[model samples]
Target: MTTLTGTERKNITPGLSVSIVLKKDQRSGKLTDGVVKDILTKAPNHTHGIKVRLQTGEIGRVKVIKTGIV
Candidate 1:
């Protein structure tokens, strides 16, 4: 909503480019840029960001919604 880090699953629509952190990279807080292809989080909301799959086939919780990012 107001903060990109706390973006809800409902707001993460398909085709929207975003930066995310994979489960393996969670400890490192690495950010992977990709386009939202599928929403995996079924809950109404999440504090750690919504989990989604990118068009590149990478899955993770969103950290940043990208602008002109692949």
Candidate 2:
């Protein structure tokens, strides 16, 4: 097992809203905010961020955890 460092995935729980960077939008550094519909990451940790599916059916890695109103 290896521990990931530098830009590692953030802690995300189901039902929590978060901003993610999809594969298609990673180049533009864009962020899509939505409620966490499902957590695709099963391992304890990851390097490239946690993978999850948003309520809107978009899949991406969690970049920021959206807490307050946007």
Q: Rate the local accuracy (lDDT) of all candidates.
A: 0.82, 0.74
Best by TM-score: 1
State the lDDT of candidate 1 residue by residue for 1-70, as single tens digits.
2335536776778998788999999999999988899999998788888999999899999998755433
> How many clashing residue pairs, candidate 1?
0
Q: How well does model 2 score by local distance difference test?
A: 0.74
Query: Across residues 1-70, which tens digit of lDDT does each residue of candidate 2 receive?
Result: 2222213434577888677889899899798878888888877666677888999999998877755543
Each prediction's RMSD to truth: 3.9, 6.9
Q: Give the TM-score of candidate 1.
A: 0.82
What's the CA error at residue 59 for candidate 1, in Å? 0.6
Instruction: Indicate which candidate wins on lDDT.
Output: 1
